[model samples]
Target: MDPICTLAVVGAGTAGCVLAARLSEDPNTKVLLIEAGDRMSYFTKIPLTPTVAQQGPYDWSVRTTPQKYSSFGLWNQSQIIPRGKGLGGSGQINFMMHGVGLPKDYERWESLGFKGWSFKDLRPYFVKAFGTASAECDPEMCSADGRCPYSSIRFENKKAASIYILKNHRELDNIFVNKEIVLAAGSVKTPQILMLSGVGPEKLLKKLKIKVIARNEQVGKNLHDHMNTPVYVSIERPISITLSKIFKFNTLWDYVWNRKGLLSFPPMAGVEYFGNSALMLFAMGSASERLMRDLSNYKHEVFRKTFPFHHSSSKEGFIFLATCTQPRSRGTVSLSDISTNTPPLVNPNYLQNGRDVKCIVKALKRIIKIVSSKPFRDIGAKIHWPRPERCQSFWNGSRTSKKIPKPAKTLNKDLVKRTTVAENDKKDRVKMNTGNNFVSDDYLECVVREVAVTGHHAGGTCAGGTVVDHKLRLKSVTGVRIMDASVMPSPTSLYPNSVLVSMAEKAAEIIKHDPAIHHDTLQKTTDRRGGGRKCVKHVRQNGLQADQVYIAQAQVSENKTKDANRCGINSAFYRKKFAEVNTIKTTQQCH
Candidate 1:
């Protein structure tokens, strides 16, 4: 028989590993971590086999709705949204080009009403996760005070982790929760689980004939991913680690014997090419004060402002890559079927916003400059950009043999009615019969619409002030809280695995200490500060059964004012803002 536990954390990925390990430290709370797949394997240990690892049983193999503005991918499929199925999640299959966001981004969150999410609040978690950056990266490659202080990607799977893995729950069954269920299943599936459990937008739920437990309209809105556009480059000599090298036996011996080969390094690891989003856009498209002013209004702006570039690291010459580090376009994650057995309809809606299109256009221009730079010139590197009329040939390959990106599929009639923006854009868009340049706006926009893909970082589904509160609790629900990329008001500054680990660290801290014995210790902090206390009564949710006796009181001191602020306790600002629930709930009216 399975032993019951205090906390049931779903998804034994990066976030679940951290949460389960940290939460289990308190012997009083038994953690039941559930995953749809098996534990860590040998392939995850090998940093070089990212592509191979993603193809096997460990991958979720999700694809978006055929993209309207971007190529779906080869073999008549939408672009793949790669999600890891086993332990370690995407961390197991990710390229391991680890990174974090700018500190100022958190500060911006504070200004935007996320009080406890400032850099000062989240810095300790970042330090706990990845340690710190040691020194500034190369000046030419970096645009800021770049510091990659430390490297801690050595895999250690056997550190008091999980012992059991339950792939799925039975149909029409109830999960008995002692305290709460923590949803850290990640951005893609967390919302799916919630909607399946009947907590999501009422319309979406109603459409699928699923019973609605809560009316959280923003359950899967605000989905964002880094927009990536790759330009293949040709170098005169063998400088980068490429596919040609992988075909050779000598390269294998170099990796196995000396650990000094292409396999050991992630794509464009130490070397960098960073450019500011605002500056590059201005440099490329000339000045538009409206566009520059519009930059600050975006949460994507709070992300890494500079676009980071890398190489395909191929022998014939590597591919020069450009990514819109922060994209303004937003998408949604919706239910395809009522069953959890089906994957959610994930639509990152890549390049829905005109601003994101403009951003990537600038990014493509930047890639051209990098190839043109003297350093690249010395290495005989030139951009091998493949457009509709272009293809790579060792000895003047024929255009007919080239892989042409097939035209995007026709818009779904239902999707067409809902997506007025696309129809309008399509109507106004003039077909370019002629006009192709290595660095032209129209040329690049065509490439982006045809070949641009996601950086595989989808986040900001259950964002703050939307589906969940600042504490990541599902609005109008109790005994549940979210802990994943979906809760992030926006995507992280860089690759989000480390940041997800840190967030789990912080979330585990919250779960363990909430209404626990530590209140006595926290009480003293208030005493030391000579702060007054208030017993703040907040309904876990208002619309409950008339006989429902769900009452939770939060005893907050001035030291913990942020908690009170979030719950609408003594803060007059919040009280006035939420005047509907100012005094107290009348049981008769509430029910």
Candidate 2:
């Protein structure tokens, strides 16, 4: 007999592992956890080299369908959306920047019919899952004893400057939070799981031959992401170098001798910033106290060391100005085929919204201004990709290209020349259609069209309430549920891992007491109750068998006399008499 398990959790990434571990706490419940990839313990736990987590056994490198809005056209290059297949999910590969979403973000969910999912309500779960070691503590916002690990990177230099930048920018000081799954599997895998589990558009599922459990047309729709265009500056000296080279020969010896140096830091140490005014306000004030506390508790010891000050670069250093905010552009995730193992079709319509262009442009300007401050006058920073001098030209070209009008064409000259001009004019009707028009606008339109990219934050496939009902249950199905970031009604400006964790935590709680928990067992018991009805059928069959046996015995007795007379004298006459007698006897018995 197959072993029976009370709960079967798939995908041992952040949410999966956490759910399994937490649910298994009850000794009575047996949990069967399945992961498509290998374990990610070593890769996830170590703080030194998180970037390595993107490759090897832990990563699930998924590709997207070619985007229509992009300049590459139908045959454009595909986008690669990576999610960790191993344990801890994308959290193992993430930059480890802990931040909580704005409170208004959650309130928006409440408005959308996702009851009990408001930021205010979900705060405790986030606090319960993580422990913080950062010096700052907002008890209401954070917790000290949580199962999930939380810490900040320590810096070696310019602590004051780092603090100044964070303090001056209220937006950067916003706290991040997490609770259950950590949902760090990134954008690609989250929606892929939802589509595979039969919770997406009906047309896409039918095309893939997947039976539709729920007909949510909006499952993979409305995917939006933040795209970062790197502006590099050629530094005269390398300000930040890895410990791998500095301690090459004696690296192992140093680590063994003392647990110190560059080996302790995470990859790509950086601070979060919001250039968009609306986002800045939302991050600072719109969020709840609990979320703020959870984020404030994260101690970035590594970030503090790497980005210590506004002028914390080498004698000549580069600054990575990222546009952390995004526009509300949407896309989709649909099934490629019916096979569960096959990946889904992902289409993240990045930069489809015009506002996103404006946001990115604003972010670029902010980065230029910050680096060109009076304190950095002597450092002499230069914008590498789009030089400061070309800002005007770039902006102008972008604007002009967006507004170019369609060209107008008159009827062919051949028709006009063949007939009298007046007669031709009277016969022919002018057609006004903007079907084929080449943009002759400024340079920015062409450039904007050429440089668009994705931020890799696709979401809202199994969106809460809108697609799936509030209990995380599929709106049309009884036994299914969606626990990934696809359940998010909308993508948050901050990272989604923490939010996903909290959502999973809530899901796990609900599952523990769900009616479906005993549904199978109850069904089996009911089947046994109906088993008695089969006995009546067996009795009827037995009666029919007995009647057939009696008829066969009577026929044998009747034939015995005819057989004996056949061997004696007058065999033909005897046989004929016997047949006649039998027929007469049969007719008399029937009467």
lDDT of 2 by residue, 45-155 (tens): 434445455545556656667655542311243555556664455655654544557887788778767788888778887775454221211222211110111111111
True lDDT of residue 504, candidate 2: 67
TM-score of every prediction relative to native: 0.66, 0.60
lDDT of each: 0.51, 0.43
Global fold similarity of model 2 (TM-score) = 0.60
* lDDT top scorer: 1
Clashes of 1: 9
Ten residues in a row with the worst lDDT in model 1? 146-155
